[model samples]
Target: MVKSPVPVFLFITAEAVALLANSAFLVVFPWLVLSHTGDAGKTSLMTALVTIPTAVATLLGGRVIDRIGRKPSSVLAGLGCAVAAAGFGVVSGLGALNIGTLIALGMLAQAFLPPSTTARDALMDAIASVGGISLERLAGIRQVVFSLTYAIGPALAGLLLTAISPIAAFWIIAGAWTFAALLTTGLPSGTSRKVSEAAITPSGSVWKLLRSRRAVWMAVVIGFGASVITQPITSVLLPAHFRDLHQPQLYGVSVSAFGVGAILGALLYAAVGAKAGVKLYVGGVLVTTAGIVAFALLPSFWILALGLALGGLGSGLLAPMLLVAVTRNTADNERGQALGVYNAASLGASPIGLGLLSLLLQRHPDLHAGAFAVLGVWALAAVYALTRPSVIVSTPGQQQAADTAAV
Candidate 1:
C-alpha cells in the first residue's frame, strides 16, 4: 500500500490554496466589472464568458487526467491559471482593462479551473485507494477544506477591495495560484496500477457510456439542477441586490455564513458516513431550494443570512453525496470521464442560468425576489422530477455493501 502522507497532504494543501485564490477572484472580478461599468448585465455576461470555456474544458478534462496522469495535469492547470491571473493583473495595472479585456482574461483564467479540479478529484481517488482511506471520508474532508476556504476567501476579498486597488487584488490572486502550483510538485505521479485495462479503454462514445448508467445520468442532472439555482443567485443576483441596498459588506457576510453552514453540513456527513441514497440527496436539494427561497423573500438581514447558511449547508451536503454516488457507480478507469461529465454538466448550467438571470434582471430589475422565487421552485421541480423512483433505481448489492463498509 502507498502509505506516505506526503501526496495526500500536498494535494489537500494545494487544492485549498487554489480554491482560496479562485473564490477571491470570483468576488473581485464581478465587483470590478460592476463598479467600472455600473451594469449588472455586463457583469453577468462576463461571468458567462468565464463559465462557458470552463465547461468545455471540463468536458475534455477527464481524458487529459487519464492520459497525462493527475499530478502533471494538476500542476500544469495551476500554472496556467497563475499565468492568466498575472497577465490580467499586469493589464489592469497598465490601465488597459475594459469589459472585453476582462472577459478575455476571465476566460483564460477559468479555462484552467475545471481541469485542475478534475485532476484533483482523480488524485483523491487514487490516494484513497492506495492509502486505504475511505473515499467518503476523504470527500468529507475535502468539503470541509473547501468550506473553510470559501469562508475565508470572500471575506478577504471584500476587505482587500475595500482597502486596496483591484489591480493589487488580482496580483494577490496570481500569487496564490503560483503558491498552489508550487505545492503540486510534491505529489506522486503515475496512474494507479490497480486499475483494470478494460476499465481504461474507450468502449465507444462517452455519451453512450453515460446513458448506459442511470446513476451517472442522475448525478449529471442533479448537479445541473443544483448549479442552476445556486450559481446565478450568488454570482449575479446577490451582488446586484447588495449593491442596490448600498451594503456591499453584507455580501461578504452572506457568503461567509453560507460557507460556515457548508462546513457544518460537511462535518456532519463526515461524522455519520451516511449512504449516498437518492432519498438523502433529494432531501438535501429540497432543503437547499427552501433556503434559497427564504433568502430571496426574507426582508431582514438576519433572516437573509440564515437563508444563505441553510442553502449553503444543503448544497454542501448534496455535493459529497453525489460525488460518492458517482465514484461508487463508475469503473475505476472510467471514473475520470464520469466525473468530468458530471463536472461539465454542473459548470455548463451556470452560464445558462447566469445569462437568463442577467436578461431577466436587465428587463425587470425590480423583480429580483420574484426571479429567485421562480428559480427556487424550478430547482425543486427539477429535483423532484429527476429523483423519482424510476429514475434513480436501487444500487447493486455489492456496491451497497461497499458503500456501507466505507461509511
Candidate 2:
C-alpha cells in the first residue's frame, strides 16, 4: 500500500546483527572474567561496572539521537561497539587483559547500545510509516527477529569458545558490529527529518513532554514490572531450579522452548495484533503470571517446559504492546525520549529484582518456589495497576489518525 520496504527490512537486519553481537558478548565477557580471574566477585563487579554506565547512558542517549539524527547516531554507535570489541580482543590476545580493562571495554561497548536501540526504533517508525504498516505489526516483526537472534547468540558463543578462543569470539563480535555499521549507511539520511527538526527546537524538553503524557509514564511502569518479574527468573531462579533437580539438560530445553514460544508469539501478534485492544495486553500479563506460577509449582519436567514457553509467549507480547502504547501516546519529537525512559525503567528493574530475590533466598535458602510465587503476584499487581482502562484507552481509529499525523 506504500512505497518499497527494503530499507525497513535492512534496518531490521542491521539491528538483528547488532543485537546478536551484543548477546554473544554478554555470554563471552563473563566467561572470560571467570576463567581468567577465577573470581565470582570480580565477575560480578565487572558486570556492575558495565551495567551502571549503560543505564545512565540509556537515560541520556535520547538527546544525542534526537540531535544528531537516527542514521548517523546508529552508525556511530555500531562503530563504537566494534571498536570496543576489537580492543578487548586485542587485549586478550596480548595476554594483558585484566578486570580494569574488561570494565573499561564493557562500559564503552554498553554505553552505545541504548543510542543504537533508540535509533533503530526511530528508523523503524519511519519505515513503517512509509510502508503503510501499523506500529504494532512492525513491533511484532521486530520482536520475532530479536527472539531468533537471542536464541542463536548464546549457542554461537558457546561453539566459538569451544572451537576457538575468547579472543576469536571477541573478534567475531567486532565483525558483526562492523557489518551493522555498514548497513546503517544505506538508510536514507532524511528519513525522519521532521522529528529531528522538532528535536532541535527549543520546545523539545523530554521532561515536559513526559509530564504531558500520562500513558507514556504508565507504559514505563508496566515495562518496569515486566522486567523485574522476568529477568531474575531466568538469570537466577531457573538455573537454581535445574541444579536442584539434578538435570542440567532441562535448563537448556526450557530455555530453548521459551525462545521458540517467543518467536511464535511474535508471529501471531504480527498476524492479528493490529486490531487487538487493551484486553489483549491484560491477557498477556495474566498469562505470564499464570505461567510463572505453574513453573514454580509444577514438578514434572515437561510441565516446567510448557510453563516456561507460556511465560515467554506472554512476555513477548508485553514488549511490543507497550511500545505501541508509548509511540501512540507520544509526539514524534518526544518518541525517542519516551523510549529512552521506558528502556531505562526496564533495565534498571533487573538489578532491583535480582537484589530483592537474592535477599529473599538468603533468608530462606530452600524457598525458591516461594520467591517465584511472590514475584508472580507482584507482576500481576503491577500490570493491573499500570494498565488500567484510564491509562491505556485508545481506539484503532485514534491510533491510525495519530500515526498518519505523525508521518
Candidate 3:
C-alpha cells in the first residue's frame, strides 16, 4: 500500500507552507511593527496578540476542523495567512501601518491557523491509512519537515527584510503561503475518518485525560517537558548566552545546527520505528539533559551550539513518539480532538515553564545553571512515565502493523 507520490508531495508541501506561514510571522510581524511603531515593546505586543489568540483558540479550531473536513480547513487557514500577509503588505505600502491594525490582523490570521494544523494532521493520518504508512514514520517525517522549515524560514525572512522593505517581508510571507495553499488545495477530501468522536465531553471526562491518567498522558508529559527545553533553546537562555560569548549574530547558525540535528534524529527514529522508539525516547532525554548541563557549564559558543544541537535531537525524538502514541490510542472519530488537546497542552506549557524559569533566574542569579537542572529532572520524569505499564507501549510488530495499515 505504498502511498501515491502526489498525495505525499501535497501533504509535505502543505505542511511546509503552513509552517512557513507561522514561522514567518515571528520574522515579518516584528519587522512590520518596528518599521511602523519603531518600538520594541510594540513589536512584542503584536507578537503576543497573535500567539495568545492561537493558543487559546486551539480546541475550538479543532472542532471546526472536524466539522469542515481537513482540506477545507487547511485552505481556509492558508487563505487567512495569505490575506493577512497581503493586508500587512498593503498597509505598509500605503504608509498607514498602525499598531492597532497589526494587532487586530495578526490575531485574526493566527485564529485560523491552529485548526488548520489539526486538520492537516488528521488528513495526514487518513492518507497514511491509505498509503500504509507507519504513524511513527509519518510523525518523524513531520518533525523533520517542521525543523527544516524553521531553519529555512528565518533566513528567508531576513533576506526579504534586507532586500525589500521590512513591510515587504509580509508580502513574501503571503506569497509563500499562497504557494502552500495551491499545494494543499489538491489534497484528497474523501470522508475516510471523522475525528470529532474522540472529544471528551464537558462532563469532567476531559479532566481525566488532562490529569495525565490515561494513555494520553504520554502526550502530556512530552508536551510539558519539551516546553522546558524549547523555551530555553529559543530564547533567553541559549541566544543570550551565545551573545554573551561574542557570537551574538550566530544565533541563527546555532539554532540551525539544532534544527539540522533534529532532522537527523527524526530520520533515524523513523527508520527504526517503535522498536527503537522507547529506547530513543529515554536516550534522547538523557542526551538533552546532558546537553543542557553541558551548555550551562561550558558557556563557550561552540560548546553551546553542540549542546543545543543534542538537546534539539532529544526534543525531536520526544515529540513524534508522543504524537504516535496519541494518534494510535484515540479512535478515528475523536482523533482530531485528541490531537488538538495534545497540541494545546504542549504549546500551553511553554509560557508556564519559561515564566517559572525566568522568575528563578531573576531571583537567584547563582541558580543560572541550576535552572536547566530542573528541566533535566523534568525530562527524566517524563521518560519514566513513558515507560510505565499503562502507556500501551508499541512493539516493532505493532509499528509495522500500523505502518502496513496506514498504506
lDDT of 1 by residue, 1-407 (tens): 55766666777788899999989988988887888899999887777667668877887878766666677878889889888888877887789988888888889888898988887877776776655666767778888998888878888899999998777788889899889988987765543323444556473467776766666677777777777767777766677778878999998788778878888878866665445455655666677776777777745678888988888888787777778767767766677788898988887776677667777777777755545655665666565645553334345455545444644
Tell me the lDDT of candidate 1: 0.75
Cα lDDT, model 3, residue 255:
75
lDDT of 3 by residue, 1-407 (tens): 44565677678877987797678777877777777777888777677767888776677766666565667777787788789778877876687767777887788777777777777776766666655667678778888998888888878777777788766667777887788878877766562343443443333354454443355655666666777557655776666665666777888777776787788888877777556745676676677676666666656678878987887787777677777777776655455667778777777777776677777777776545544555565657555664652353464355435444644
User: Which 10 consecutive positions of candidate 3 have the poorest summed lDDT?
Assistant: 191-200
Question: How do all the candidates rank in terms of lDDT, highest first?
Answer: 2, 1, 3
Between prediction 2 and prediction 3, the one with superior lDDT is: 2
Best by lDDT: 2
Task: Give the alpha-carbon lDDT of every model.
Answer: 0.75, 0.77, 0.69
Better of 1 and 2 by lDDT: 2
User: What are the models' TM-scores?
Assistant: 0.78, 0.89, 0.86
> Who wins the TM-score comparison?
2
Between prediction 1 and prediction 3, which has the larger lDDT? 1
Q: Model 2 misses residue 19 by how many Å? A: 1.0
Clashing pairs in 2: none
